[model samples]
Each structure stands twice: as structure tokens, then as C-alpha cells.
Target: MLEKVYPPFIFNEFDRKNKFGLFMDVEKVIYSGVTKFQRIDIFETKAFGKVFTLDGVPMTCELDEFVYHEMISHVPLFLHENPKKVLVIGGGDGGTVREVLKHPSIEKVIMCELDEEVVEATKKYLPNLSYELNNPKVHLVFEDGSKFIKNFNNEFDVIIIDSTDPTEGGGGALYTESFYQDCFKALTENGVFTAQTEEPFIEKEWMIRAYKRISSVFNVAKLYLGFVPEYTPGTWSWTFASKNIDPIKDFNPEKVRNFDKELKYYNEEMHVASFALPNFVKKMIKDI
Candidate 1:
């Protein structure tokens, strides 16, 4: 039996092959194989039977990383008239970079990942999702993104932080106020920055706190939602903070369609609609 523990939940026992039992928390399915590294996956049967992966194996349930990655990367990129340079923080899987490079107008993309193992693991096992790493425009940097941004000076037209949940180790700094300040300083006058906030259903308070801190540093702050199953619950939230520029006003569907044809979720109408949060969530973050 395989033994692993996750926060907010616990994995108790594993089947000889691919099943697992949770401690009254949830049920999990495990996939064991070798592409790069050994891995374990957990799924919550009640919540869309969502699957979460660790290391290199497919967990009991599955969540779509694409929907969130596309929305976060394209929203700011499509809004910009011609985004020549972009920065992605913590998306070592290359999913975010893959989407960012879809725009023909983008000349350079710098991805700063804290873990090289994560990059290698994803590249080996999740090849289809990480196909964009081969693009000539992408420059991968394995280091601390916060430190990298501090030295950068007005260099990017768009910045996207496609990171893991804040509770995860090494990812905690991504939610800090100083990180937002550095993001503000790293952008051009009209540049925009966006990040993957947590699930409104579970981490609403922390999400709002992050929004408030970002609001203090950037002139414009916006929160939006998309459904991702791998994360806690099922719904995921993303927050955007900009130095100067109304993200919605800057978008034109016709122009974005010219760049890529693979997008399924983001359109001009959806762009505006996503910002319309439910009254419950609205009330929760209203002050922020």
C-alpha cells in the first residue's frame, strides 16, 4: 500500500494496484507508472470526483488545468494591443507558457520556475499539455520569481503568475504584498499582471486578502472565475491587478481570433461575464 498525506485531508490506505482509501475525507485512485518520476494521485469522489496528481502519476480524479491556464494567460495578453514581452511565474509545467505563446504578437516569453524537477516531470509525463516549451520565444529560468522581478525594470507588457495554491511550500511567497509591488515595478506603464487566486469556496478569505494587497499596489484590480477540478472543491478563482489599463476595454475579439484558433472558453462576451461574480462572493470581497 502507498501512503501519502495531503492538507485538509488524509490518505490512509492503498490497494495493491491503483485504489486508495481516505480517512473519512474522500476516496482516491492512484496511477503508478514511470515517465520521469514515481507519483501518486488523489481524487475526491464527492466533488466532481476530481483528480489531483503528484510527481508523475495520474491520481484517482482529474482536473482540467487547461481552462484556468488559458483564461489567466490569454485575458491579459489578448487585452494588450501588441504584447511583445511576457513573464510567467511558477508555471513549471509549461501550460501557461504554451498559451502565452499562442499570440503571434508576442516576441519573447520568460518563464521563472522555482523547481526544475517539476518542469522535468511535467515535460516527461504531460507532454501534450506542455508542448509549448519547445517554442523559440520561451526562456525558462529556474530561480525565485520574486527576486527576478525586483531587478527587472519596466520590462514586460504582461505578467502572469500561474502558481500552485499558497499553502504549498515554496509557493507561499507568491501571495505576499512585496511580490505584487515587484510585479508593479516590473511592468511597463500600461502593463498588466494576473495570478491564480484560490478556490472561492475554500480559500475565500485568503483570496480577498491577496486582492486587497494587490489593490494597494496597482491601480486596477479584478477577480474572475473558471472551473478547474484538480484544486479543492471544484471552482477556481483568478485575480488580476494592473498598473494602468482597463482589461476589458482593451480587448477586441476579432484581433485575438486572428492570433489563435484553439481557444474554447474566452471570447469577448465571456471576458466581461467572468468578472460578474455571484452575490455571495461579491459580498465576501466587496471591501477589497
Candidate 2:
């Protein structure tokens, strides 16, 4: 009998203490190197298409990215009556920008990314996500996100923080209370602000802390869930904060129903359902 061998699997150490992690079969490495801020890896996986990872953590992939990008952009967009100017912070891959461009009413989108190399890598290897980054209405700014918003007040209609996990590399400052205050000051009167809050199933304390901080800054703060298979535990959360708009009570489903773009994961019903939290998640954010 002949012995069989398989390619090695790549494991992401999401929970180091418990030794819990997720693995993907890497087909090929498109690009791998240490950028100025963090380690960037672009690889083709058997399960998902080309994936972008920072510091050994899965960020986004071609397969299930629409679920995350659409939910993050469209939820607050539809809730707000007319969103003209948009700002995206730390989404170097351009997935969030692509989704933001779907709304016809948007006049401009400014994407502020900390690392220029990440944008270069995405533009080279991940064209599907990065193609829209060059659109006429999109402006790419390579700078620190925490400091970028300080220059603006009553500017953007919607601000999306499509950043990596807070503890990973330099993204920790993005989740701070002061940064949330800056985001609150940067938005217009009816502006909506949102960020990718960590998965509660794996990082409960982080989620609670983020929720408390955001709640304290914004007049109305709420947490929503989305299913991103690439993320640990197959679940992800996003924090939505607004100066005046109520995400649920003020949400207009007709705006979403009238959206011309073809969406994959997010829909009118899912928009409402996404806000309905499970018992544990409700309990987690209740006292925070």
C-alpha cells in the first residue's frame, strides 16, 4: 500500500487559550509579505475564493463578502432619507466602497486606509473587490483612520468603519471611546456611523466594551448581526450609532425595496431580522 499525503492546512489562532481555531486549505499564495503596519497575505482557498488576511486573521473573501459589505452599507443608508457624502475607514480591500457605490444618491466616497500596501495588494490580486476603488466618485486616502475624522465636522452622511479586529495590529485605537466621539463629531445631522464589532461568541468582552463605548457617544446605539463564514464561529456583529436617526423605528423598507442594485445576502426582510438579536446577545448588550 502507498501512503497518501495532503497539502498542509492553514490554521487561524482565534482563541489561543482554548486552542480553538479555524483552518482553510490554501490552494496558492498570490502574495505574502510584511507591510509597514501588518503582515498581509493574499491566497486562494478551496472553500472561499481569493482571501485577504492581516496578521494571520481572515479579513474578507470573495465567496461571502457581499453579506458583510452590503449589510454594513445598506442598513444605515436605507434608514437615512438621502445620503450624499460617504466616508469609509480602514477598508483597504474596497469591498465596502463597492457596496457604497451601489446607491445612486451617493455623490462621493472617501476611503481612508492606514496602509497603502494593502490597497496596492488588493488592486493587484483582488480586482473583483478593488475594481471600484478607482471609480470617479471614490477618493482613496492613505492615512490613520483615528486621526482622519478629526479634520471633518458635519461632513459625511454615513461613516463605515470596515476595520480588522481591534486587538490585531494597529486597529486597537479605532475601537476606543475617543475615536467613537470623533466619529460622532464628523457626521452630519442625520448621519449614521457603524463599525464591525467583534463576534460575541468568541470575544464577548470586546463586544460589550465596544457597545458601551459607542452607546455612550451616540444618542442611539444598536448592535446587529451578520453571518460571515470566514469569521470565527461563522457569525459577526456590527455596531450602529446615530446622532438622531433610530435604526429600527425610522428605517424605511421602501427605500431598500426600491434600490436598483442586485444584492446577494442583504434584503429588506434581512435588514429587519438582522437587528433581532438572540437571547444571549440581547443579554450581553443589555447591561453594557
Alpha-carbon TM-score of each model against the true structure: 0.80, 0.94
Distance from true location, Cα of 167 in model 1, Å:
2.2
Worst 10 residues of 2 by lDDT: 1-10
Per-residue lDDT of model 2, residues 16-111, tens digit only: 543786677888878887877888887788888887888667789988988889988888888778889999999999999998898888999999
Tens-digit per-residue lDDT, 102-196, candidate 1: 78888999999877766775676566566888788989998888788887989999999877556433337888989999999899997888998
Whole-model lDDT values for every prediction: 0.71, 0.86
- The best candidate in terms of lDDT: 2
- Clash totals, every prediction: 3, 0
Question: In model 2, what is the error at residue 279, expressed in angstroms?
Answer: 1.1
Off by over 4 Å in 2: 1-7, 13-18, 168-171
Q: Where is model 1 more than 4 Å wrong at Cα?
A: 5-63, 168-171, 257-259
**What residue pairs are clashing in model 1?**
41-59, 51-61, 51-62
**How far in Å is the alpha carbon of 93 misplaced in model 1?**
1.0
